[model samples]
Target: MKIFEIVFSPTGGTEKVSGYIADALEGEPVAVDLTDCGLGFRTVAMTKEDVAVIAVPSYGGRVPAVAVERLGMVRGNGARAVLVCAYGNRAYEDTLVELEDAAKGAGFRVIAAVSAIAEHSVVRQFAADRPDAQDAVQLAGFARKIQQKISEGDASEPAIPGNRPYKKAGGTGMVPKATKECTDCGACATACPVGAIDKDDPRRVDKKACISCMRCVAVCPHAARAVNPIMLSAATKMLSKACVDRKECELFI
Candidate 1:
């Protein structure tokens, strides 16, 4: 059976967690980047014999809108799917359930689920350097358990947590802008998943289109793109209480 690693990681944190699990499960799984704007999701087709490790970052306690949209386009074709939601220390309220629903809709059979921790995409201090050594060991163990379940032909659907009607998505009005260090190299524009940055003028960003994914900020070679300091500080303060305590990875099978 083929194994596919399907992921949407804007700042690389989610990718790191997903990669560990995928590696432990399969030697060289096919990677399907949900962040690649050039990819045609509709063209991605899988069979019942294939397995998919679908991973996404939890954005505001739920699945990111872009990820949901992109995932919808692919046909799972009855593949067994393992859903993973990587979050910064805060709770992943509806992400796993929503992802399960999405994968089921795409013709995948939900077999397992995981809630993992990663460095905060915006508030870097929260869960910083997560999916660390400890996380790696935990995720690897989880992957082995999932492999066992698949081998045993367990068809029981995992009971993932979350409500049928997901909570209203919270908006982070925080948007990044170009700084003096910006070299107008257009790297951010090229890397932006949503085309929020103007290709011709890298400095010009469409706030309405921007999901505040921070791809631009993370990809900027000159450290030029950043959210307003005041806004970042306020956000950091708001999240501090919820993000302070160390959280561990939880697996459902």
Candidate 2:
């Protein structure tokens, strides 16, 4: 059976956690990027014999709306799935349950689940440099357990955390703005998962379209894009208490 690594990582943190797990699990996996809005996920069909690692970052204790939309279009065809929710050291809350529901609705069997820690996509200081060496070891260990389950032909669904009627999704207002150094390079626009940046100008950002994922700021080669410092500082201070401690990875199977 083939392995699928379906991921929605706009700022690379979620991808890193997912990669660590996939690396420890069987063979090389076929990659499926949910962040690419241009991809037609409806055509991504898999056989019942296949296994899939569906990973998405927890955005405000919930899954990104766009990731859910794209994942809905894909045909899982009864493939066994490992659900992973990578969070920024805070609680994932309803993220994994929501993701499990979405994956089941798309025809996947929920065989395993993981709650992992990663660096925050927006507030850089909170959980910074996460999915680090320690995280890698934890995730690899989780993957091995999942492999053992698969080897035993156990398809039991794990008890994932979160409530049904998930908590409301509050929007993050930390939109990044381009600085004077911007050369209209369009790199941010091209790399933006939501197409929130204007390709022609690269300076104009569609705030409504932006998911506050900080992808533009990370992608800007000239370091010309950034959120308001005051806003970032306030957010950092607000979340400091919750993110101060080092969190550990959790696996359910």
Candidate 3:
């Protein structure tokens, strides 16, 4: 079966986690790049015979608002779907449920779901190099189980993770402020997945438009970007436990 892999990863951590899930499924996964600035709502029609793996990173325990906005373009046509939410070791609050709703609204039949963890999108200390060898092995086994379920004609929806009323997940509000090192090279603006940074002036960030995916921080050639120090300190204390546990990738079939 054809597997459509939809993702909105700016730091590549989410993409890596999604890759493992797609690899496990044994199909050529086509990426629906929400990173494209020109991206907007569009529909993708799929028949009952096909399947889709919808994956996204947990932005502050929720789906990136920009990603959610863009996902409205997908037309599932009642295609069976597996919702996969990858988080940065902290938690996936409403992200999974939101994705489930989005897929259903797009005409996809919800089947299984997974909540995996990767490195923190902004900060580098948590769960680095994740979706590593161990993660791949786990994901491969999970894929095999999912395949088996499909072959056995099991169509029941699995119990998704987390509570009904999702916990409050606050944003870091860590807008990466540009530093003197910035040459106004415009790379950060160009690489911004949500088009948050203005192309002409890299330092200028549209806070309302910014999803704070940290693409600018990661891609800065001169290490010219940084988040507010106060926010970083606050986030560090809040996420310390999460960083210590080294969360793992999960699978459900």
Each prediction's whole-model lDDT (CA): 0.91, 0.90, 0.78
Candidate 1 runs further than 4 Å off: none
Residue 5 lDDT (model 3): 80
Q: What tens-digit string does per-residue lDDT give for candidate 2 at 150-225? A: 8888999999989989999996578999998888989999988899999888888898999998888888889999
Error of 1 at 240 (Å): 1.0
lDDT of 1 by residue, 1-253 (tens): 7889999998999999988778877534799999888899999999888889999999888899999999999999999999999999999999999999999999999999999999999989899899899999999999999988888888688889898799899875678999999999999998988888999999898988899898899999999999999989998999989988999998999
Q: Whole-model lDDT, candidate 2?
A: 0.90
RMSD of 1: 1.0
Q: With candidate 1 superimposed using the best TM-score fit, by how many Å does residue 134's alpha carbon deviate from the native?
A: 0.5
lDDT of 3 by residue, 1-253 (tens): 6788877888888778777767777555666777776754474556777778888898777777777767777788877888888888887878888888777878888888888877887767777777688877887677778777777878888866665566575654678879989999998998898778888888899987777788899889999999987888888888887678877766655
The whole-model C-alpha lDDT of candidate 1 against the native structure comes to 0.91
Greater-TM-score candidate between 2 and 3: 2
TM-score of 2: 0.97
Ranking by TM-score: 1, 2, 3
